[model samples]
Target: MGMHKDQRACRRVDCHDRPILSYGHMVRIAHVTDCYLPRTGGIETQVRALARHQAASGHEVSIITATPGVKRSGTEIVDGLAVTRITAKIPGDLPIHPRTRHHVAAALQENPVDVVHVHVGVISPFAWGAIRAAYQLKIPTVVTVHGIWGPLASPGYRLSELIAKWATWGITISAVSQVAAKTIERAVPTLGEVLVLPNGIDVQDWQLPVRQHDSSTLNLVTVMRLAPRKRTLPLLKIVKAAQERAGITMRIHLRLVGDGPERSRAESFVHQHGLKNLVSFTGRLDHAGIREIFAMSDVYVQPSVKESFGIAALEARAAGLPVIARSQTGTTQFIRDHQEGLLAQTDSGMASAIASLAADRALLAQLGEYNRSTAPEQSWPMVLARVDEAYARARHLD
Candidate 1:
């Protein structure tokens, strides 16, 4: 069966007066992603949020993902959303599932979706397979780029983009940030028209009362996966350098949150520098746990130089904690330098910014207040409005 743009846009699907779309009719949207709830990352969070928002808007939403350890593959209802999980062996970061194409086809046939949105990445067997299946089924497809790309990652990413371009028809492409869109444009020059769909967070959950720090000891917090691109080890070394310079006059305590591939290396570096007294590693924590930590911290630090969208940093800002991040990253798009937080070019610069904030609590409070006021605009409703526009464009109605 083939899906098409509605001949006449409906003013209401059933009884509500809300127009289906400002430009098109309502659709049963199917989201295909490489990872989901069991896996924790920025992409997982955004996908889950978008699905919830779409369902809340009265659209039937279905999620198709790989079940890494499940013995059986089947449909399940998760928080009012329909999920079809396909059993597969996931080795390393990417899951290699040759059966994904068959699974996707079966799921779509059983569920019958109107729009297929594939969240694309470098090694996404399920996502790539879903895109091909949607094309074969003659369903409209949208590919949202979720992979981070740079000079180092470009070779493989360019290859993947070329393959994607050749594998599907009438596919609309979207990126999570302006930086990501530019990267896609550079990687696939022939694949014209990439939309920028920025990631969003639950602002209400992060709207905490301003944190209070000890007058003598300043608390620094960083919540990120301990990966190479995150620069967690280097960040710890920078903190050690700052503490060494501060000596007995200044006291600095760093609380590192989240666990990842580089955790062991970061821990070794901390031990090598004799920073056990200054740095505390709290492994992985849930949203509530992270919010509690944010409520206690004086400042949030983002060390990743290759972030497509700094969701964690944005969450910290919404919690009324001033951010200090690398100026070269996508975080700069949201957190203005010297306004909401300080952006630094180098490790030494970041250290200096942290030390300055610790010494001046009033300036930090002013920045936090400004961020809290502006952060609500990055909520799920704002994100879904843009997603609706993207869906309209995908249907060739916009």
Candidate 2:
């Protein structure tokens, strides 16, 4: 009887004309990530945005993520995506990977998805379980490598590479950025099928009314974790140098918006350097708050010695703020030397770039204009379309 109804439904012209079937509903996808909401980072934001967009586009979308300490029992629908958070034993206060085999096995049995997309970063036990479950079920998998793996060189990297090679395909967010892509390819040559999809921002958010600020008082902002890799101390040093080198006596205010293990060190650096008057720390904030900070700032600077995509810089560009970023890593891809924004390779170079932008109002306005024009191309909608296309190719291969 069910078969007869399904056949009749398939034959009905109205049913055949449904948007779901017409616009790629034939593909059911399960997006797997180690961290979801509550745990914030570039990877988490990308996963949430991609999943929300995919679900809204009529694809059968679901997420399998590790539950935070306060576990929510059972599956919950969030923004139309079914999110299943599984509990895991905390080994010495650290949340290990969830024993997801049984839960994933059950989810797969119920839904029988077509493909699984894993957002790779911060290798936890849960990530391992997801990889194992996907492979055991004969489901084709695609892993998105969000960060460079060489420096970490941990057991997690080896395990992640093994799973990525076994998966149907591998993808890197900064594919066009040679540095980021090459790093991954070096680690695992079997990841040759990797495609780059640059992280995007909502262009609409960048269109906010530019806060009127005195050009003489430059408001510079860097939104990143207070870690050694971010090179926040160097940024503070550069700001101090700017005051002396430029002789402008500009009231340069540096707002650092993320906290980490290096928070105390960063704070101490600010005090030791007597930059307490010039720098302020606003603990990590939500996306909206970050955007608001960008909207008010005259300039955005990212000094990370190593960055995969530098999503913060992208967000700043979308907000029409002139950016001064390091030329190292994937940041160089978005910043054109003297064209869209300034790129500095060394501490002096970064300081010089910031000073130059501060001294020239016309140049700052031009860079801001260029950023606004180019930001729309990197919107999440376009990025997700590329992602969906990649999923289609993975499905075909399967």
lDDT of 2 by residue, 145-164 (tens): 67664566686467545645
Q: In the order shown, what is each candidate's alpha-carbon RMSD?
A: 4.8, 5.1
Model 2 Cα shift for residue 371 (angstroms): 1.5
Which ranges in model 1 have alpha carbons more than 4 Å from their true place?
Answer: 1-25, 69-71, 89-94, 163-168, 245-247
TM-score of each: 0.88, 0.84
Strongest candidate by TM-score: 1
How would you encode candidate 1's per-residue C-alpha lDDT over 47-148 as one tens digit per residue? Answer: 988898878777779888875423235777777887777866556635557877877987887666667888866556678788788777666677887756
> Which candidate should be chosen as best, given lDDT against the real structure?
1
Candidate 2, residue 269: Cα displacement in angstroms equals 2.0
